[model samples]
Target: MRLFLVLAFFGVLSLSAGVLMSGDDQDVDWLIAGGLFGVALAGEGARLWLRRGRAKSHESSGI
Candidate 1:
């Protein structure tokens, strides 16, 4: 879970950098790739979070 969150954080940083890039360093393909990578990492992080929540709930309910 913590690992996933850390990956998501790095992904977000990459995406932000891609979007905010300017001058001669900007590339549309790189921007799109970064955005996709960020989304994927964030989705995985969210899945981990939801799975953790469901596990806790089930344990509490004696399921």
Candidate 2:
């Protein structure tokens, strides 16, 4: 979970940098940015899924 958060943070940073640098130049970094953003999304989704699973398990266990 922490690892996913870190990866997502880096992905967001890279995406921001790419967007900032691409000032109408059709830069290739845009692709990198998109990919990073996708990773970020995936990481966040996975994190949420894991958290939800944990919560359900805890509920079932009466913890």
Candidate 3:
């Protein structure tokens, strides 16, 4: 998951710069960048939620 998040982050970053600097959007990167960004964001959110739930359960269980 960490590797995936890093990969997605770089992909989006590089692709975003490429698309913006280019004079046209006639490339596959434009489409792929959005997907990578979305996946990364979703992964981050899931990880955050899971961590919070774990902490709450741990606190309740007196562990």
Which prediction has the highest lDDT against the true structure?
A: 2
Worst 10 residues of 2 by lDDT: 25-34
Model 2, 12-59: lDDT tens digits are 797787877788875647776877777777877798899999898877
Candidate 1 regions with alpha-carbon error over 4 angstroms: 1-28, 60-63
Q: Give the TM-score of each candidate.
A: 0.49, 0.56, 0.53
- C-alpha local distance difference test of each model: 0.71, 0.77, 0.70
**What is the number of residue pairs that collide in model 1?**
0
Q: Write the per-residue lDDT of candidate 3 for residues 1-63, one digit (tens) a residue.
A: 775768666776857765765556555455556666667677777888999998988775556
lDDT comparison, 1 vs 2, better candidate: 2
Off by over 4 Å in 3: 1-28, 61-63
Clashing pairs in 1: none
- Clashing residue pairs in candidate 2 are none
Residue 55 of model 2: what lDDT?
A: 90
Q: What's the CA RMSD for each of the models?
A: 5.6, 5.3, 5.8
Backbone Cα, N, C clashes tallied per candidate: 0, 0, 0
